[model samples]
Target: MARIGITGHSNLTAASAPLVREALVTQLSLHHDRLIGVTCLARGADQIFARAVLDVGGSFEVVLPAADYRDRKVKPDNAAAFDELIGKASQVRTMPFEESNRDAYMAASEHVLSSVDAMLAVWDGRPSGGRGGTGDVVQAARERGIPVTVVWPEGAERE
Candidate 1:
């Protein structure tokens, strides 16, 4: 079985979404029936990864940053998808923070890194814009000697 984690940008352009999703599906398919995806279940890359994992017959686990993440961080536009993905997760873990913040997000990403064999980063090769952004997660995974695959398809662009 292959257990993979995901970290990615939340502001991918609409035209790039399909390209990223296709790439994720292709990568997840390699693990086939024994695939297990680990993610924070955030809006962009995480949600896309979760869907791809399920599409490839894999079960995914969620690592929530904080107790109030769903209410505070998950915007209304993305709430339905988040709820559906949460419902489909094989396991859901929340960090010990009452509020969602950068520290909590980093901690949750660390938690995901600790259990996964590999990490998939849907990034654009840019530096992180904030404390717990995609670059930080990818860097943390690399520092921990976890294999990371950057899945920025040819035409993938950030918003």
Candidate 2:
């Protein structure tokens, strides 16, 4: 079993989000019952990934950049979902932070990436907002010799 890391746009849904989620879950399920840890922050891809981890009967973990549950005040929906995931997770780690400095981002990423045997990155073809370049995180995992899987949605042709 491999521990997979998940990430994607926090606001995407329907056409985009579900497709990416499908691709990720498909690949992760291949790990069979050995699938152990699934790590995620708290946001769009994070929420979707959490649900998928539960559906697959795999272990899930959340590593937050905030101190504790207090960050909820800034993200009611995300906070609620994060809390819900916490209940479902086999393990949860909180690294007090505000998502403002590089230190926090690195710490959060470190926990999420290090916990698992591999990383699953959901890509929508662009840089994410304030969460640092997810591409960088994926690459970092590679540098650590962790396997990385990607879920990319086929964008509709432009008019």
Clash number for every model?
0, 5
Candidate 1, 83-105: lDDT as tens digits: 99999999999999999999999
TM-score of 2: 0.80
TM per candidate: 0.97, 0.80
Alpha carbon lDDT of residue 111, candidate 1? 96
Give the alpha-carbon lDDT of every model: 0.94, 0.66
Model 1 steric clash pairs: none
Report RMSD (Å) for each prediction in the order shown.
0.8, 3.4
TM-score of 1: 0.97
Candidate 2: residue 68 lDDT (0-100): 44
